[model samples]
Target: MAQHWIATRPGDLEVFSFEPYDAPAPRSGEVTIEVRAAGMNPADAKHVARGRDEDFPRPIGYEVAGVVTAVGPDTEIGSGTVTVGDEVLAFRISGGWASEVTVAASAVFAKPASLSFAEAANLLLAATTAAEMLHVTGVGEGDTILVHGASGAVGVSVLQQAAMLGARAIGTASGSSFGVVERFGGTPVAYGDGLEQRVRDAAPDGVVAALDCVGTDEAVDVSLATVADRSRIVTIAAPDRAKDEGFIAIAGALPESQAYRDSVRADLVRLAGEGRLVVPVARTFALADAVEATELLMGAHPGGKLALEP
Candidate 1:
């Protein structure tokens, strides 16, 4: 039987047994992947705890990287575009936290050979969210960007992407995590009392844009105070409040366009392949320790991207 982590109900992590069904052959335009590592994100726990659709026994996960074990019939991916045994990374509709997953060909990309399983798994969600924010807000070279919660996985991704685009990035993080932000090519400002003044000191000319990964009222208020164009400020965390405050808001659960996923996947893979991207993974858990992993991820301590290896 293939192993998978299933949350049978809200607020607990339990394993439900499953008989190994034959790996479903992909239909045309689909491909099957043998998952090596699953990226654990906050949304996974939130969905399991909150129960988004009443679909109990839900398999929760969004990003994975592994090898192509099978491809669907009549699909170009089967004919060497993505051959059997090709290493790949995928973003799935569901069931990513599993031993195997079937995804659309368009959704799977070649995993860079240079990346470890954990690093490859870490790329999808945070990197994709950062890419979408940059795209929708039209931030570009020479722009000064202020990023909130700059030490989290999404915050680090945003800092790297902004730097790659030739923009000046000023990131706000707790004093303990300031070094992380600075290592990713961002100017780090402490995020607390006098945050506005700290940001001004970092970017004397003023921040032209802001991306909020932390939903604090303080983050929102300081971003609003610093950026001249409210439309140029976007928030991924506090969508409701962001809307109330007139800043552009985006949610990973509800993105502006489907193509946004494709763009992020492409950019991330290319960057990792070329050694230009950094995926800081602070911890990894074995598949058997999934429950513990979830608990740690939910904790208040500082860490980078965490993954579960199977």
Candidate 2:
């Protein structure tokens, strides 16, 4: 038996109950992991809030770091690529908060030794989101990119990855978060009224691409004022505005985004292992304390990533 957190319904993270579940059995091309840590994201709760009308008592979590305990028939469990007892990180799995989970082998990767289980657990989704945004926006050398919500998980990743691509990052955040953005290699700008002017003053060379992580009208409006090319501006949030407005809207919910994530997932893991990427962890929670963690994730930016230890 194993334990996991379940939401009886959406919009009720605080009412969750941790319950016992049968150990998972892996099917072909799948593996069973004994979860060590699970990542907490706003999307985990928001997706449930969207509600499928079925799949009640939904298990909540997105990514986890763990040990492989079992593999399906015809699966090479002992292979160095993946093996029993080897530490690894897995993503896009349902019921990920459980003590054990069954996931497709293709979605698993070796966790870097440099990262703790908590940090490794938080890595994949945010890093992949950053990669997808930059790839779609065509950010590169000589480009001045504006990243809204630059202190959040995905925004920080965007700043670091943009720097890796030789692009200048102008990150918008509260004045308190300016240091965070600068550490990630972004020139920090305060986000508020007159955000456009602040960005303009920061990037005198002009902003060529914009990635909006905040999904507010302010972010969208400022992005438009700076980047003339609509194709060069994209928002992971504000899908409605993306449709009514001209800029691109990409999210994990979209088919294009799913394909894009599949292509670059492994590379992101590789970069982290090489120490070229760093994911800061603000806090960790016991699996049973997930409701508290969710509350924090849903409430405000915690200054870094949140993880749950199983």
Candidate 3:
């Protein structure tokens, strides 16, 4: 029987047991995958905890790295582009925390041989979002960009991408995560009281643009105060508040362009393959221990991305 994690109500997580339904044969444009590792993000638990009032169970996860098990008829992705045992990373429209999943061929990418299932699983959403924000803001070589909350998965992706683009980057994190920021080639500044002054000192000349991965009032205020162009300042967090504060707001979870997704996947895989990217995995749990994993993910001081192995 295939096992899956499901949430039936707000703040509830349960392992639903079911008989092994025959794996669905892929349709014309679909591919079936045997999931190996599922990456969990904050949005997974938040969406479950704020479930719809009608009381329907919702399957949660969005990114997974697995092996292609089946391919649909009349599709270009025959057993060749991806084969029965070829490893792959997929970005599902919904419901990825399962023993198996069906996805559109477009959302699947060949997993780089250098990345483990765990690292591939963590790449899609966070890396894609960071790449999109950097692209949209026109951050390029020689530009100076500031990233708020520079220690999280998304934040680290931004720091790395900015550096690859030859831009000078300054990232803010708690004192403890400063080393992580620096490792990603960013000047690290401490957040909290006196945050603005800290950032100012780190990038004394001035910041040409800013990206807010943290969504705090301090982050917003500091960016607005330091950047010369508001249009160049973007926030992945606090979208509504960013609009009110006159900064560009982009949603990382829902990327607007398929090309953007492809670009992110390529960049993530390439950097990882070349040992230029570092995806820190703080903890891991078997699929059966998803509840405990989610709890730790929601708690403070759990450093790095968390993954679930199926």
- Give residue 281's lDDT in candidate 2 (0 to 100): 96
Name the TM-score of candidate 1: 0.92
lDDT of 2 by residue, 78-188 (tens): 223666788988876777888898888878888888888998899988988999999999998978899999999999999888989999999999999989999989999
lDDT of each: 0.81, 0.87, 0.80
Residue 190 of model 3 has an lDDT of 85
lDDT of 1 by residue, 1-310 (tens): 4577777777745533232434467888998888899898888887777774478867778888889888787665411378889998877457777788787887788888899988999887888888888887788999999999889988888888898889989999888998899999999999889999999999999999999988899999998999989989988878888768887888755645456765567767888789888898988888667778878887875379888887
Count of clashing pairs, candidate 2: 0
Model 1's C-alpha root-mean-square deviation from the true structure amounts to 2.3
Give the per-residue lDDT of model 3 (tens digit) for 80-128: 3766788988874466777888878777878878888888898878888
TM-scores for all predictions: 0.92, 0.96, 0.91
Candidate 3: global Cα-lDDT?
0.80
Residue pairs that clash (backbone atoms under 3 angstroms), model 2:
none
Best by TM-score: 2
Candidate 1 wrongly placed segments (more than 4 Å):
12-23, 77-80, 255-257
**Model 2 error, position 192 (Å):** 1.0
